[model samples]
Target: MNQYPDPHQGEPWQQPSGGNPGWGLPPEPHTGGQLEPYGNPTGGYQPAGMGGMPEPTEPTLDTIGDIAITQNTVITPSGRFPIRGTVWTTTDMSRTEQSTPVWAIIVAILFIWTCLLSLLFLLVKDTKTTGHIQVTVQGGGHYHATQIMVSNSAYVQHVQQQVNYARSLAA
Candidate 1:
């Protein structure tokens, strides 16, 4: 055996020829595609349209807004409700109050031993809001209630605006 075989030499079956790149088989017919439902070249398969199977069609959907509403349904966080004859209700359950922060109380206690000026820290006031608004929808044999957390009166007003939009949609 030679360390480096001559490039001119190849297997007995190897021959340089530019006929068809297809492996030995003749070129296939230009049918729509290989995976098309057309009949095979052989007699076993039937022609495309001759088959008993029906052509498939995609179902179209009617939607409103981004994805919350459809032709007959109003999708919500709590559940789906009928858009027709639907009712929307909102209740504000938030309360706001002013109080001294825990850090301020702690600071006042730690510095009270040093001087009377430390008592001023107790005067620091913070306004905080806590609670959520409950929204309820009922119609077409269904009922659902969902709560939207509110941090301030502005957010409560925003929720009211959204409910108003829903009312318009229902009407």
Candidate 2:
């Protein structure tokens, strides 16, 4: 076999004129495992360190201050309407074990609702006939004879107090 350096090419050790620095060796094929040209030498995959996974981002407490508790109410000539009363807390997965009094209050509400339903059922089934009353107030008796059914005034007064208290708080 004869290996000769042509005059047009130069000595075998020297590079040829107008030839690419890395001649047609199929410009290194890209691999997921290996770094690519014009790409991060560490590849796109980020390990725990060295720009691998992003540092766990934390929400700023300043942004936390944006959270607000709102209570809304509306009053008409007849009665007051409590629109919204809620408590909201900002938290993440780390607060799984946290407790709020809202749940207890909700349970108490459910229990009271159950008791009220039972009382209503009793009122419906009891032999005591329900009679309507139309008592006229002295000066501000603007509303004409409204049918007020006599069925356990105790619970009615209790609910009215709750609604009034809620109205007061909103005011």
TM-score of each candidate?
Answer: 0.45, 0.18
lDDT of 1 by residue, 21-125 (tens): 432344456666346334555444332331555323223233222225554667654445457789889888999999999999999999999988999999999
Q: How high a TM-score does candidate 1 get?
A: 0.45
Model 2 — TM-score against the truth? 0.18
Give per-residue CA lDDT, model 2, range 1-171, as digits (tens). Answer: 324436675544454434545432344455656455466675553324224545333332111111211244222234222334322111111111223345455555667765654333322222222333332211122221132444454534543444344434434
Model 2 Cα shift for residue 64 (angstroms): 34
Model 1 ranges with Cα > 4 A deviation? 1-67, 70-72, 77-81, 102-124
- Candidate 1 clashing pairs? none
The residue ranges of model 2 lying beyond 4 angstroms of the native Cα positions read: 1-70, 75-150
RMSD of 1: 15.5
State the C-alpha lDDT per candidate.
0.66, 0.35
